[model samples]
Target: MDIFKELQERGLIYQHTNEEALRKRLDSGPMTLYCGFDPTADSLHIGSLLPILVLKRFQLAGHIPIALVGGGTGLIGDPSGKAAERILNPQEVVEQWASKIKDQLGHFLDFETKESPAIIANNYDWLGSLQVIEFLRDIGKNFPLGAMLAKDAVEARMSKGISYTEFSYMILQSYDYLKLNEVYGCEMQVGGSDQWGNITAGIDLIRRTSGDQVKEMYGLTMPLVTKSDGVKFGKTESGTVWLNAEKTSPYKFYQFWMNTDDQDVIRFLKYFTFLSLDEIAVLAEGVEKEPEKRKAQRTLAVEVTKLVHGQEALERAEKISSALFGGGLTNLTSAELEEGFSDVPSATIESPEIGLVDLLIKGEVVTSKRLAREAIENGAIYINDIRYTDVETSVSQLERLDGKYLVIRRGKKNYYLIKFK
Candidate 1:
């Protein structure tokens, strides 16, 4: 099947320009396509995953893929989706973020392959060198004020009073496309639905600047992902789901997918995983026939975790999950415990041994020794997954996991980590 049809089937295509020409271009032969990622943060979040996957999809289809890092344009943030002007980062900080994002982009694409290896380009390479006069005379002449004002990005921000710096962002992005087309023979640009205006602007800029020399250029955008309940995707009460392991541990990342709402799991599998349509359809049948088993959610979590964090990390995440839910913590490693309990309540104590009641009070797992004793009597207190019904029970180094920590559970879900210093 053609890439376009495949994307349509997977619900990736939101909007596109010149569909016939793009279809003909893809059918004729392999072509180069580019997607830009602005370095607004050091790590890309779940929101950025779709575009990166699109670039990978093109590369896997025997087409050249160019991943552009917006080191230059990030200085003047794109006002596509924001209601307020962005607080610009210092040049050094922007450079650091750009470098990190470039490295992260590499994980998704194969750069060493002999055929159509992925290319990474930074817009700063050429953008930082353009003179003010040259920019105004050569690039700025193509964008008229009325047309710029009419763009959805600018129009949305007009009521909020956008600054000229942000108003000029589309031109810079358009210039990026022109440069990529000239240098890398990139004929298509793909992004989220919010970037439809900017993507089309680039196509127009290339046509106007290069005149008859420029071949047909295309713009494609994927739908902005949202939850079935109408809330935004890729967010929890804590914050965004980051790609960096440090920012969001592989354990939490795996759980995020594992807890996917039954209404959204099948849709997300198509968008995020490279599984075949028939395979996904089978999972969909399981979702209906055996919703209680959560087969689809588990598969989604495993596939996505393995893709982002690799097999080793996925195994560790699974081990952590199983140990926590199935009472199998006897063999957890220190690193696994750290990742698993990274967000759990924790306390540090100098002594390696303490009475059960004292430990509960000191670790703030209970309000007072009286309450702790009551909980123990009621069989609600557990240490290292072992029920301790005696209030006088001592928790010593013998009960510590990895010889340095104790896992305390109050009732079924509340977990506390006690560190022995």
Candidate 2:
């Protein structure tokens, strides 16, 4: 199947300008396709995954992918999907975050080789240099104010008073397409479904500016991913699930996928993974036969985690997940154990010299040494999975896992993390 057909089947193609013609153009040669990442935050969330995956698909199909960092447009803020005016970060902060984002993209896209080596560009390179008069006359003239005002993002915020700067975002984005077309012959742009208006605007800009002197530019967009229950995708109880491991650890990232609802699993498999139709069909069968096993969910989580976090990180995340949820902690790596125990409630002591009863009292695992002794005597307190019967046993008797982390269980289901300095 052709690229467009495959995207449609995978639910990746939301809307494209002249889908047939664009597919024809893509088939003709190794075209340079582009996707813009607006550095709205320090790290990308799950919402941004669609475009990155699309770029990967284009690369796999022998097309060159140009990843655009929206250092300029991010300053102005695109109003495409916002309910209110975004608080613009100071330019310096945005620049810093943009650089960090560029670094983080390495985990997903390869930029080393010349043959389809992923190319990166910052829109600030061109946008920051343009003069106001030049912009108004040359670029602004093509966009009619009426058409701009009719957009959903603008119209929704119009009642709340959209700012002039926010209103002009489409124009700036259109200019990005024009510049890319002129400089690198970048003919295609990919974005989320909310960006349909902006993508078409860019396509029109390329047509108007180049005056049919070059090949027609293309726009491909993926649908905004939404959960079946109406909550937004990529969000957790805490907030956004970030791509940066520091912001959202690899284990949590994997759990985000592992917890996918049965209904959404198949669709997620298609949109996120490069797994072919036949392979997905097999997974679908497994989902039918044994929903309790959650085999498809595991496969989806594994594939996505590997893609985003690499094999080593994926393995660590899996180990952490199994150890925590499966209630078995002995096989966990030191890093995995640390990650699993990081958020649990715990207290620390300088040394293992204290007696078990006094340590439990001091560590606040029990209110008093008497209570701590009773719990241990009744087989309630576990030190490294062993029930300590002797209250006089020193804290040194506790077996430290990996020579650092100590898992303290208070009765069942109440766990505490302890680390020795």
Q: What value does the lDDT take at residue 136 in candidate 2?
A: 95
Q: Write the per-residue lDDT of candidate 2 for residues 1-421, one digit (tens) a residue.
A: 3777788888888778886788788788788888899899898888888889888888877788888999999899988888888898999988988998888776677788677788889999999898999889988999988888887778888988889999999899988888887888888888888888888888877777766475577787888998998888998876889898888888989989999988899999999998898999998988888899998899999999998888999999988887776666777767787676655677767888889888777667889767887988998887676678888888787778888767778788677777787
Residue 312 C-alpha lDDT in model 2 = 94
Query: Which residue pairs of candidate 1 clash?
Result: none
Writing each residue's lDDT as its tens digit, candidate 1 over 1-421 gives 4888899999999999888899888988888988999999999999999899988988888889999999999898999999999999999999999999999999999999999999999999998998999899999999988989999999999999999999999999999998988898889999999999999889888888886676688999999998898778999866889999999999999999998999999999999999999999999999999999999999999999999999999999999999999888878988888889988889998885678888898889999878998999999988889998987787763467887878989998999998888
Q: What number of clashing residue pairs does each candidate have, in the order they appear?
A: 0, 0
**Candidate 2: which pairs clash?**
none
Q: Which candidate tops lDDT? A: 1
Candidate 2 segments exceeding 4 Å error: 212-215, 351-383, 386-397, 409-414
Per-residue lDDT, model 1, residue 214, is: 65
In model 2, the number of clashes is: 0
